[model samples]
Target: MSAPIPNRVHYHKRDRELELGYPDGESYRLPIELLRVYSPSAEVQGHHPSEAVLQTGKRNVGLLNITQTGRYALKLHFDDGHDTGLYTWEYLHDMATHQQAWWENYLTRLERAGASRDSGVIQIHQV
Candidate 1:
């Protein structure tokens, strides 16, 4: 097998999906819902690991636009008005490669915490 080639990539926004393509012919279609829930913005990821917020009710989310951020990342605009995450090329690649595992882990977390991705009260106690 040949080694994977690193090439410039682009993100195309559609109604409900985002298409990512590279010059090396590697491409993937990522659902908007997944992208929204897993956004890398401070609002979603927070400043620290423990401060991360659980995103809810994003099953029907859609991408509104894609803005270039310098030469390293892209800012994704969502129909829900979420446009803070600066998705670096590395981050996007990782998300595409590990999507299934990431989603499964997310679901497991919700189940373990008795939290629903759509609606659930979260109580964070600082010690």
Candidate 2:
């Protein structure tokens, strides 16, 4: 399939989601937390898989601002002072499609690392 182009983008603050509407009458609501954790920026995803950072304590992060990047992406300004990720249409589409799976995987990773979604919450496991 050709890249899924988004015809509309709406940020619902009350629900904490960014909705993407497609020409095909399809839409997906992505939580802000999800976007933060899976940011496409090098700071989050890193230069390589092995260098990727595990984003934790971001359950309540909000989008402070959003600006389009030419014709391909949007630069999201997160409330936590992160404003680097360029969320392209293609990247958003892929994330929307695979949200559940990726979210579950992220939860698993957090659990393994003894981290919590609540900001600054980390379990101290006795060695």
Candidate 3:
């Protein structure tokens, strides 16, 4: 089944989230921090899953802009200068639907790497 396309999109500056409204009356608020850390850009996701980079110090990152990419995706602009990710409709819907589980997994990964969400506070892991 195809994912639902959002009919409305709004970025909440104060809350630092992107709110997506669907035609079926379901809505989701996706955090800016979550979007940044899970960005689908090659720089973040890498060429392979095992090569994916761990994003840290992104709690203060801002969502600068959101633009359409030929109706299939959205180009997300970030204040941290990351603007390569293309968030497709299907990806967005899936992300919003499974955000809780994905977020917990992100936290687990961060903990395993001794990473911090706050800026400039990285813990060096001796390997």
Per-model C-alpha RMSD:
5.7, 1.5, 2.0
What is the lDDT ranking, best to worst? 3, 2, 1
Task: Indicate which candidate wins on TM-score.
Answer: 3
Local distance difference test values of all predictions, in order: 0.75, 0.90, 0.93
What TM-score against the true fold does each predicted structure earn? 0.78, 0.93, 0.94
Better of 1 and 2 by TM-score: 2
- Give candidate 1's error at residue 65 in angstroms: 1.1
What is candidate 1's lDDT per residue for 1-127, written digit by digit as tens? Answer: 3323335434445457677777778877777778888899999999998988877767767776788888777888888899999988778778888889879977876666666655345646558
Clash totals for all models, in order?
Answer: 0, 0, 0
Q: Which runs of model 1 end up more than 4 angstroms from their true locations?
A: 1-15, 117-127
Candidate 3 residue-wise lDDT, 25-75, digit = tens: 999999999999999999999999998999999988888889999978889
Query: Residue 96 in model 3: shift from native, Å?
Result: 0.4
**What TM-score would you give candidate 1 relative to the actual structure?**
0.78
C-alpha lDDT of candidate 1 relative to the true structure: 0.75
| lDDT pick, better of 1 and 3 | 3
The deviation in Å at residue 38 for candidate 1 is 1.1
